[model samples]
Target: MHEMTIVAGVLEIAHRQAAGAGATRINRVVLEVGRLAGVEADALRFCFDVARSGLSAIAELEIRDVPGRGLCPACGASRDVDELAALCEACGNVLDISGGRELRVLSLNVD
Candidate 1:
């Protein structure tokens, strides 16, 4: 799965940071998972454990979910979305994506 590669990338970054701080262990990793990022939280967690097992920073994972913000193309109104994708409910028009496409580590904790 692509999640393996994605987790590997995260661990690589963690390793760099750990080396910079001379840390022997990682305690936590805070992740932001946006609704439009197309990354499954469960799958990411599974991959993260495997990826971090042999690494220096085998940190605990914390995911913060971010909801998609859809702006109406016709009226320019912004609202929270609960449906399949970015869509405007007020004007019945396809939405222009305003936010919520991010998948990244928000912060790292090391010891």
Candidate 2:
């Protein structure tokens, strides 16, 4: 699905960074995935495995999940979330999420 394409993009960028930095291999990649990023973690992992072939970096990847933060307007609280339907724990009001809906490369550890 779209995860394949997304993984492809990731590889392209990681390849460039690794090559530019004169790193023999990319040891790890840290991605910040938002709760509403609409990306399936399992699917992304599988796609990454398939897409990283023949690249300068060997087939090794480490994924770190970043939880989304939602705002409880009714309660004026900020909370972390893993689900789309987030409710305020203080008053059980529907929480409005402001950030963490984007998939971004936070950092990469290279050799």
Candidate 3:
């Protein structure tokens, strides 16, 4: 699955960062995943558990969920959205997405 690829990349980065900092191990990794990012958290967690090795073998994965938000341009109303093509409840018009398209590693705890 694509989550394997994503976990590989994340572990690569984590390993590089840990080595660069002369750390013996990676304690934890914090990822920010948005509702509209199209990533499955459970899949990612499973992939991470399978893919991690060496410095990150016992690293804990923490995922932060970000909520999708949108604003109705026509009615100046804001609301929570689940998809990119969400319709505004007030004016029945397409909403301009404001947030929740993020997929990035926020931080890493290393020793």
Best by lDDT: 3
Clashes of each: 0, 0, 0
Q: After superposition, how far is residue 66 of candidate 1 from its true place, in Å?
A: 0.5
Q: After superposition, how far is residue 42 of candidate 1 from its true place, in Å?
A: 0.8
User: Can you write out model 2's per-residue Cα lDDT over 1-111, one digit (the tens) per residue?
Assistant: 999988888888888888889888777777777767888888888888777754434646566666788899887988888777899999999989877687877788887
**Candidate 2: where are CA atoms >4 Å away?**
85-94
1 against 2, candidate with superior lDDT: 1
* TM-score of every candidate relative to the true structure: 0.86, 0.76, 0.93
Q: Model 1, 1-111: lDDT tens per residue?
A: 977877788777877887789888878888888887888889999998777854343578899999978888799888977544666767788887777787787888888
- lDDT comparing candidate 1 with the true structure: 0.79
Cα lDDT, all candidates: 0.79, 0.79, 0.93
Model 1 stretches with alpha carbons more than 4 Å out? 54-57, 82-85
lDDT tens readout by residue for model 3, 5-100: 888988988899999999999999999999998889999999999988999999999999999999999999998899999998988999999989
Residue 95 accuracy (lDDT) in model 2 = 89
lDDT (C-alpha) at residue 52 in model 1: 80
**Lowest summed-lDDT stretch of 10 residues in model 1?**
49-58
Candidate 3 local lDDT, residue 53: 90
User: What order do candidates take by TM-score, descending?
Assistant: 3, 1, 2
On lDDT, the stronger of 2 and 3 is: 3
Which one wins by TM-score: 2 or 3?
Answer: 3
